[model samples]
Target chain A: MKMDVIQPFINSADAVLAQGLECSTAIGSLSMEEEAYRRKGVAAMVWLTGDIEGRIIIDLDPETAVRVASKMAGAELPESDSLVRETACELANQIIGNAITALNDQGFHFRVHPPVMHMSEEGIKSSEDTEALVMCFETPIGSVFMNIALRYNRKRHADAASAGH
Target chain B: MEQFAPVKRSKDGQPVRYLIVDDSVFARKNLARMVESFGGHLAGEAGDGLTAITEYDRTHPDIVLMDITMPQMEGIEAAERIVQSHPDARIVMVSSVGYQENIVAALQRGARHFVQKPVKPEVLYEVIKYVLGDDGAVATAAGAGV
Candidate 1:
């Protein structure tokens, strides 16, 4: 069966790009999405619940990460790592929150798990030995990758109301 | 985030429906917001990989938004299981698990997309569009279905 799922994320992206950012800039078309993640980079992830569950990975390099951090921190330019992480954390918070709102409208409500920053060099462990999906994008800064995995065998909507997700 | 029912449709030769998955309460709220804007519907959702599998069985999500770390079932483990169960399953690793190394590990684990935190909506949407082959749109997704 086919399903309608694009509108949610699209709207969220548009809203975040235009409204959430302090100074929105042109991200442009992933010109070379083919090479979206040829090299390593920085990535952020969050989990989904209710109706559907998985992960959301936002990948970017240090350069782009720093630039995004600068804007997120309301800075004309960045010089400190703490400043960048703060902005990045906030930026992640807003974007991820908006994404959840978008999905919620789709009849799939789920609360976020939290935002974690990784350098990509650290190995990401797994539940089992198998493959996964990597949804990659080309940002003006560098590349953004959103990876996903299989749904394990467990109960359903155990905590649907408390989280409002 | 508001609660709504997921929309179901007939795929024109479609094999899988990718799901946006994560563990953070804040992140999930944000993601649900984005999904609602898409077409007012979602296949299913889960907190960890373990539960995700159950949800996946019901909805059979093709692609997934996977976080690298979490309680109970981590994204990587979930990815492996989902992929192992369904080879065609597209699991996108959505976490800031690292830069280069995790990306490769995710790829090896059957992950198709790898992104970092502080997600950009456009970037995320692009991954969904590319992976899902530009199919389906969830609108306000009015009427609670959850």
Candidate 2:
């Protein structure tokens, strides 16, 4: 049976936009669905390990992605700037951290290695048989997908995620 | 007064009611668009600290997302005031590490969580559930909660 793992991710993303950033949203927009999807321009990729072995690639269009990236970078993105990729990686890192905590409350645990965010329409190749979960978010330039990949061989730990004791 | 729409809940029975605040209109609209996907209600909305404070007082939101920096009463200031009044205010501060100063200031002001830009819905939802607890049900759907 499929654990409703993605539910927590979507909640984390909405919280990030609604509560984490402004007394409101600072900028940007999002949508949700299931499927391996793609968009034009840049994508932010964050790797995952531990109980769940997989990678989450959050892909976005350059223009909209850049606006999001610039906020994290604390500067405005120049027209056609190259930093979109870097920003996407950082965004992925934040999303992972937040999502893990939400999952932890549900008796889940995992260790995330250092994330390497970058861009690629094709993205870092995953093994063909690897199970993947992809979620797409829409923005001005286009849509971006947040992909969660997991391998079954990893030892799954259902422990307390953090220090809530 | 505009009536708030009903929100959904997780199998665990957590109601997602969100209060979104940001100076940028674009960001606000973006968040408003898909808040329901996370099973979250638009508890209320605000553009700055003063507005945040006012809304927080009225709505007593389950989550408060404030940007580290903005025009007129920044997020840090808003968080401090929210915490001061509602010591239990669940505030998750937002900023790119590029603005370490803002992030630091917000932490000092008593934010419970942190998220970066691009504001993915799943990422935000996860943190809110973690911090606010599974008690997050919409006020309107009290009977419908799990």
Off by over 4 Å in 1: A1-165, B1-18, B134-146
Q: Evaluate model 2: give its lDDT.
A: 0.60
True contacts kept of each: 0.02, 0.00
Question: lDDT tens digits, residues A7-84, model 2?
Answer: 666666555544433323322443332344454456655555555567666666667666664443334656454465
lDDT of each: 0.54, 0.60
Scanning candidate 1 chain A in windows of ten residues, the lowest lDDT window is A30-39
CA deviation > 4 Å runs, candidate 2: A18-39, A70-76, A80-82, A118-121, A124-129, A140-142, A152-165, B1-146
lDDT of 1 by residue, A1-165 (tens): 012333344334444545534433443342212222232465555565546555545655557666655443333554455443433444455555555555555555454665666544644543442223444344444444444433421455455545574
Best by lDDT: 2
Tens digits of per-residue lDDT, candidate 2, B64-134, equal 77764455776778899999999988898754322344456677889888876656556766676677665
Model 1 CA lDDT for position A102? 55
The per-prediction i-RMS, to one decimal, reads 11.5, 11.5
Q: What lDDT does candidate 2 reach at residue B74?
A: 69
